[model samples]
Target: MAAGAPRIFVSHLSGIAVFDPAGDQVGRVRDLVVMLRVGQRPPRLLGLVVELATRRRIFLPMTRVTAIQSGQVITTGVLNVRRFEQRPTERLVFGELLDRRVTLTETGEEVSVLDLSVHQLPARREWEIDRVFVRKGRKGSAFRRAKGEALTVEWTAVTGFSLEEQGQGAESLLATFEQLRPADLANVLHHLSPKRRAEVAAALDDDRLADVLEELPEDDQIEILGKLKEERAADVLEAMDPDDAADLLGELPTDDQERLLRLMQPGDAADMRRLMSYEDRTAGGLMTTEPIVLRPDATVADALARVRNADLSPALAAQVYVCRPPDETPTGKYLGTVHFQRLLREPPPSLVSSILDSDLQPLDPEAELPAIAGFFATYDMVAAPVVDEAGSLLGAVTVDDVLDHMLPEDWRETEFHLDEEVATDGS
Candidate 1:
């Protein structure tokens, strides 16, 4: 609690009150603002915004902070209501910083730096600070002034930052393009210029290159496929969804497609061929071969035990599908689905069959999109079992996968932000 003694982690700085020399509580520290420049190691402190009663706010420079103490903070000076100049929070956005100039301090001299990009890491991954990069400017005499000057810093030095992206550079843009999930990648591919997109894809690592290929639009896939090394292209196509692979291959020049397919692993090639055999819009084509199925007679406890051991994909529905063994299928009958939540609520040893919702609807391989959409909309199902004419389970169509097919091209970017506590300065 003593001033200048060991303080808590920066992440826990919010809500602690600000106090003057007399220990009178003035306001609560609200936000810590840092000014960033591209490629710099440390960003300059813009200031702190202190929220007070009557909707009043005060801005204090970093230098004014004296020491963080128990219950309150000590400041070098007090803020008077009449003298304070209040304004809405100003944030520099990405578009505004593109090709802009920023100031940087070197040896106490100020210089202009070429702003390159700004990246905001999400709050969840708050180990590093948000950073912006700039090309170092030439040294000049104008930098040293009477006192304070503006400057930018790099991302490498800061402890943590916002997940929301503000300013972006070509390099950061490519980085975002690489890390985004498949559906997101697909949506944004159209936003960048074709040349820029190709450049981004070319710069990607193997895993990321494969992911981007899997998500690209059909036309873009063909365009990029031709550009990739033959072997590399084959590897990516092999890793992609079968239907996606087949569609892309179908778009390639006949000779190139044949060569690529021949180069792919035998098993992967077969899967692609099988999917290509089906109508492009059919359930057989859209469904993933992997399914999490449990015997109709298994207990909830036993099913959960298996769930714990299985290497299931995150895309799958949590609910496990109940099915008759392949041997007993035609002779037996359609069972039902065991909802995952129900297992958690019911005591162990509850028979999965006892909890089975026999009213569970099923879809056929040849089912239409509208029928699939209707089933998903009506039941609020996360995944539905795809069955044959004889009620034999084939695969499943997950809710997320279906949405990928149905959702709009552009949605919100995955914004990152540190927790309020983590983003603030101490009292």
Candidate 2:
């Protein structure tokens, strides 16, 4: 970059006014776009994402950016009127990247990344990330942050956590995206080119990969799973919610299904085998083998701990199954379930059996989809237990799984538009 090129924190750039040459006001900065290249070098700044008064958004290339002054950005590129859709090679700094957390390699301390600064490349119109601002303290409300702890550091000093590291490939991307929720991560991944998506899928740990897989479309699920080595693929499937894993596995050809199943842990393989045996339209097919199950004598505190697992879905976490001896499902005798509402009302020292909803009958393993839907509707339950004729708890069907099966077959391919107001960096 030129020795004296203007350098400013990204926050200062955000919301700055943009004008075309001749000083005609155009729009305001919504975010900055950068293309992550290969290796340790800083990513090249591509352009700015601007939101016009009409609420439409568009990309303004860097070549057109003549100067960036306090409160204003000047551009010479003709603005395209089309709505902004992020391309695979591009990432939005303010929208999804600003103020995320990262580990400083030199100090081994984790800090919240506050902003980044860019400068023009010497003799070239291109811009690149030059500095990173950070803060150390507690996180508060989603939007508001703690103050008086901020500092600036050279970007290279921050290591092991960035999606923008040029040559590091998937590892860099995973580090860069540590803070993204599974759904948001899925959205980002869905927009990636096939090669980038495959790299990310292969790099993610089994649990993280499993979570992202659940949010993706079936075709995406198939494509990503197909990219993993057979052993790792089986591991990820085993980590997934049983119902979701079953659904994805069912979509694969018989040969691939059998091969992957063979690589799974025996118990997990057995559970999947049982779930696969049922038609997708039936209760057996829709239920998840993993649920918060507690022995009748287990305390409310114990039940609460199980539900507190961060990985559990909202619906699955809403209740706990209180079963007789043998807590493992499919063999555990079905007693009844205790809703989270009832648990909180009871004393923590109370036994789970004291709060059991004994009268809430479980669904039959063979119950059809309509019956499953009606059960959820009739009882006003977020989830319902499934049981064999022998009264053994088979699994539990969550509302999300039921809706997945009930929704239109092509629902996954449907496109969605972002709402008007945007939150910076998913904050």
Candidate 3:
């Protein structure tokens, strides 16, 4: 059988109804009695004990089942008429297994938990079978249980389903944020419940979590950080941009802030403290440690190579920043920045200084928020490098973070577009 496929296992007690060649009602699925091993191990399939209207139990071998579809089970041959044994309880409710993972023997397609469609036989309002519903068919209001609708096909919709990892449905879905754009990641974070947010974050790989955390709101960052497991929280804090790390730490309680800082690597802790030492609203305070630094004497090729090698988040700029060298003051001595796109089109061996745009659009360490926002608007730049008077680079301010100043309270429902594919029950 292929991996990550959808398959179904019918329980002995799974409801099974029978019909004759003319489709007349005959018998129903009774108990699926499997024999357990003498030791504490997995059980083996025995046979199905179906019930007939005659109130007698008929034993049928498992091989007799021909097909199962839309919740209906079919047998290969008709059985002798007899009374059925009274059932102690109703068959397992379909809703109980909606979000459960299944492995299909035929195909390897792994699908998320989605709604199921069921079919009801005519004249019998009680009998229904669950099956995969093609997305294209049943366009109107057939799925919706309004008046004149005799059937409810999508009664089996669940929050989510998994075919490979049985218990990882929610975690896997949320962990996909690592591959998403920053805006999309932010949108998903805002919609998740507090508990769910923590659960998903705990499951994410540390580096991926750091990437996603860079895009979340400060309030959300504080909430998620507080709820995360200690090790995971420390990892996220260590891997994040210095400015982002400081902002999150400032929002946390004093005790938590100290504890988390202690957990972080010393170098990372010092970097965050450096950013935090500045006034909160200034450009230096808002700057990140992720500026695209390059040697002034290096070739354009060298700068491009460094840009490719850097482990930056998605929202960062493609512009390569030029400085004399890491050992020298990068402030007033800065050469300029060259857009990687433009540099790639030029000759490879060209000196970076020749390609650099020396305009030096700099943000002062003490600049106010409005002044900084206007600077972005004036330059049409996605990011601007902050520096001190001695030409040493402090950090880079990203445009997306600046936009957070504009978001309203009801942002998630109003700003994000989501499909109604995953169904969550009130419970």
Candidate 4:
């Protein structure tokens, strides 16, 4: 849902038909899964449990959901068919929350939860249960009921759904550090005991866990991946960057790698296999397969839109690779590059081909670490496209990936106190 979209009551969502981007019905909404915070703060709407045509239920993350209107849910068409599994921190809106009595913070009068109103936070994809619809009455039995008064209140007006302050499970721990960056959270996980680490890892959502896993050491990555069910492990691996996922898969036994690869989407599996075919420190292995690729005929406006994606790393967004037909890497014949700055200066209607920077040679897929580093240094480029001998655009290598290969193996283990005080006057 877009920012400022109408709030939807959970009652209205239950049993609603769900459709993919192509307008084909995929499933029906089964339930909403949310994570309760430590206090009366609103719970984050994780996603929906959807029952497919085959009667198998799957989790549809809100990130993949594009619209909820006219009594139907629309998705991005990338549904994960794996069965929905509720974590320790998750709560089912209809199954568990509704009909339960929670006390109003001011009156101490208990009210039954009739429904919940969820709204997408402005400028963010995250949604939350921001309002509560409740009936002020004595507890009602399954068949008989006492309905005194019905009213709506802010989520904070009630108590009892939030986690206890003294809670010690991974749920509480996750709520405490919910705002930390993945790398910072990975550092926190690194110091935890093995049991605690696994608990925390399992509790995290797939996208989040994938990011944290990328920052964690190899042993931790393998250990945590092993503890998860194989289906879930494959899901997490698919969520990771293609290059990082391939690197992690390379650390596993070949049999184990193939099994997980078989579980992934065919295209993602293909990318992993292609990436793994190269030496670890080579350009092909270090580059991400999902860089922004635009056709020669695309306009400056088109390139800018792709660059503006919130998910793209700064380095990846630094420039766009203009290519022939077949935009996805390994794309059609390599054309040239269009830096973000040049796009801004060009008129929106101007074709990307007109402003191409073709003079700079693209990196070969087999380029070694030292050569790749020298190319970045000489060209002052944050990212450079990688092409095969046949001039097909393979992927783009960013400066960060080059540095990762150049750094000492134990560099991630070294502690740097970014918060340490610095002398102001050369004292």
* TM-scores for candidates 1 onward, in order: 0.49, 0.67, 0.57, 0.60
Estimate, for each residue in 38-100, the C-alpha lDDT of model 1 and write its tens digit.
564544445455655332345665457666656566777545443234233433221122223
What value does the lDDT take at residue 372 in candidate 1? 85
For model 2, residues 306-396, the per-residue Cα lDDT tens digits are: 9899888899999988777677777568888999988888899999888789998899989999999999999998999999988888899
| lDDT, candidate 3, at 189 | 52
**Candidate 3 overall lDDT versus native:** 0.56
Q: After superposition on all CA atoms, what RMSD does each candidate show versus the true structure? A: 13.8, 10.1, 18.2, 17.0
Query: Which of 1 and 3 is the better model by TM-score?
Result: 3
**Over 4 Å off, model 2:** 1-168, 410-427
Off by over 4 Å in 3: 1-186, 309-315, 327-332, 406-427
Tens-digit lDDT track for model 4 on 1-427? 7888889988778668898877788878867899999866899999998866555557889998889999999888877776567788898675556655688999999777777899999999899999988888775542344568999999999997652322112543454456667876786576555766776787788999999998988899999999889999999999998999999999999999999999999999999999999999999999999999999999999999999998888999999999897989999999999999999999999999999999999999899999999999999999999999999999999998888788777666653432223211110
Error of 3 at 85 (Å): 45
Model 3 Cα lDDT, one tens digit per residue, 1-427: 1222243433322454654434555456544434323332223333455544433345554445444455555555555333222232322122122223433323432333322322233333222333432122221221231122122223233212221232422332432233555545554455445654665566566766777787776678788788777777988888887787888888888888888888888878777777887877778778777677777777877777776755864445467777776722233366677876778888878888888777757787888778889998888877887777786776777786566544564443342432223221211
Ranking by lDDT: 4, 2, 3, 1
Better of 2 and 4 by lDDT: 4
**Which window of 10 residues has the lowest lDDT sum in candidate 3?**
137-146
Q: Predictions ranked by TM-score, top down? A: 2, 4, 3, 1
Q: Give the TM-score comparing model 1 with the true structure, all chains together.
A: 0.49
Candidate 1 least-lDDT 10 residues: 139-148
